[model samples]
Target chain A: MKWIPIILIVGLLAPFSLNTHAEEKSSEWVKVKGMVCEVCAYGIRKSLMKEPEVQDVEVRIKEHKVKIVYKDPKKSLDRVKLAQILEDAGYALEGEKP
Target chain B: MLRLGFFILALLGTSQISVAHPVIFKGGIELQGETQKKDSAFSTTYTFSPYWAVAAQYYEMREPSMSPLGRTFEASTVQINHLLKRWWNEGSQGNIYLGAGAGVFAPQGLPSEFLARGEVNADWESTTLYVAARYIYLHPDFSEDVDFKKLRVGFAPYVLEQEGLNSWFILEWRQMNTEKAEVTPLLRFFFRSVLFELGSSLDGDFKFNFMIHY
Candidate 1:
């Protein structure tokens, strides 16, 4: 009978923890060089979307930036892999912002 | 007779200007087609890397009454395109490409010949403006050599976001070896990975081209 109270409390807190984790799934903004046209944006978007961790991608040609949403927030952004993807897409990664 | 053959060959070999990029992003595939009055060309390219691509091209020139020996000149070549240089500027991009190919050239009712091609192209473009130039040389084993030079300038009416439909108006000038030059005004539109062009030369010859990348 005593264990039932602890079980009830843990169940009550589980949803809150899951919500916090979901909120932590953050988006990243990356500055890209040579992303000047729609075609260039398409290439970058297509390449980034191939990564398993990337959930969504948006490219802004005017600002030369790419916004990436990750499927798993706990996984850190691999800058080396990001740079390789940009290089393969015929662009260069200038910097990143949180 | 030889002079007439040369003239007929030159007439059949009209402008070969393609508005498509020869080398695309890594693992990209591009298909392009262009057609005019006397000539039509189709090509497929695969880009293994950002800096290099391989393509197979088929070109045909047709004129029945003008040629004494043949009605059509057909060439099928395998080409390699190298991105020699690229510049990523603040609001624009520029690129230079060099390409070469060799294949069989066959004229109807005549023995097949060896054909070789060399080309250089350069382009610079921003969201609002674009300029490009190209030169191509064709050498066949048993015929006079042919060359083409082309220049183009274009402007967009309004700037649109990446996902929006984009349109541009362009003017093209082409000069073939020892032949009269032609001027064309073209409309270009692109949505996503598909691009198409429509134009008519000042001489009233129709032009159509399309490109798709995947």
Candidate 2:
């Protein structure tokens, strides 16, 4: 019976720990020009995903923007690399979200 | 009527190469093919830069000849495509390209002749609307020269999400040299890096085309 309370306390604290860890992850939304179709978005996503630092990518065609999630919060993709990727995908990076 | 059908089929077979943009993303590769009765064309392209690409294409057409029999014409060419201009709008993009090449053209059982080709292509597209035009010229040393022109307009019935399948209804107009124009209504579908088109001309001829990017 005494072990029941210990188990409950650990279970309650695990959710908090996971939440704190998730908070450490980082994401950035960048503006990209000339994304007129889904094919354009696909190309950008395919190229960005090949980078080890990229965890996920979301494209907004109407807004001409892309949200990039990083695997490590402290280590982000450099601006030069980001520009090169977009250039290879036939797009121009217009900088980060305002 | 049969002669016209054969001519249209031959034109449609070679038309697929002009349907998509010639230049793709840097280091990208594309494969495209189209087929109809007695005619077919295939091409492979490599994009070395954002504005330049090289492609090799093979086209075959079986058409009626003056000798009471049909003759097959085959052409193979290596072409370089250049993106001359591009425009980016708020929700649309436009591009113009020029291409030139030299190859061999031969009719079955005939000596091959040197062939030279040139093309001008332009297009503008947004999420909901699309428009394009192209002109192609072919000159062979031993055969009559040929001119081909095409125009296309399309519209999407609904907006497609990033991960969803995209569909469009397109109408195409084509003319070969001084021949009568042919109109075709096409259904286009694209998912990710692959695209396919199915259509039938008003003359009851069928067409199918597909493209893949890697």
Candidate 3:
């Protein structure tokens, strides 16, 4: 039982440290094209809001672009799904390759 | 009056400095073809409309052939509409409006003294208020010396109307000393404020129109 205290302390501290690291994760900015008008932008914003990991969506009508920030970068988002959201909202997605 | 209108818009914009309005510049292009029992005609039209202000619309139409051998004619018209609109049920986001306007038309074959003009329209929106029924009166000639009598009714509903896409489906009936009817459905797409429209009229004619706003 001599090493029991040290092992328990390390086990507890490791999880706590990992929790801090997870909380410190920063989101990346994703740019989307063809986001024109408040109506179109609002639709995308609403659809993305359903994802718990999504933090915010900002659409610039003049530039026809959208900037999305997510809370967790590790969460895999389906690009095709996002593209479909845009298409249904009456916009053509661009700037995926370049 | 134009300056006063501009000033009012400026004040309205300033008052809502932190908020955004739904108003935006709009334009439309139309291609129409009509054929009676024996005569068929084709025409292209362009129009520009400002948001939240009275719109002065102009149209130039041409009849490539009016007779069996192809007698051609051209006509032009200008309309000024003073529109008053109201939006209701913010949650539903629907719109209803009643408006009246006047217009003047100069056709090739009609006496210039019998000028044509007058219009009234009422509209309702389900998802977006884009279509309406309009009644207009036109005198085929109005030169400065003669009084003319003509009236036309149109059931025009916009197929698509947003900041980016605008289209109209129009069916018209006329009683200008005669009874006639014309149906047309127009499809238009807008990109960068430019509009391209394709239309088919009941008279079994097809046409296209392209327009840009500067």
Best by the DockQ measure: 1
Q: Could you give candidate 1's per-residue lDDT for residues A9-33 as a string of tens digits?
A: 9999999988776545468888887
Query: In what order do the candidates fall by TM-score, top score first?
Result: 1, 2, 3
CA lDDT, every model vs. true structure: 0.79, 0.77, 0.39
lDDT of 2 by residue, B100-169 (tens): 9887777678788898988899999988899999997778788777666889999999875556788999
* Span of ten consecutive residues with least summed lDDT in model 2 chain A: A89-98
Clashing pairs in 2: none
Classify candidate 3 by CAPRI docking class: incorrect
Error of 1 at B25 (Å): 0.6
Worst 10 residues of 1 chain B by lDDT: B6-15
RMSD per candidate (Å) reads 8.6, 10.8, 14.7
Please state the Cα-based DockQ of model 2 relative to the true two-chain complex.
Answer: 0.37
> Tens-digit lDDT track for model 3 on A1-98?
89999999999899888876554334433454434334445555655666677788765554445666777765535566665544333243464421
Give the range where candidate 2 chain B is weakest over 10 consecutive residues by summed lDDT: B6-15
| Residue-wise C-alpha lDDT for candidate 3, range B141-182, written one tens digit per residue | 433221112222222243223234434343333222232444
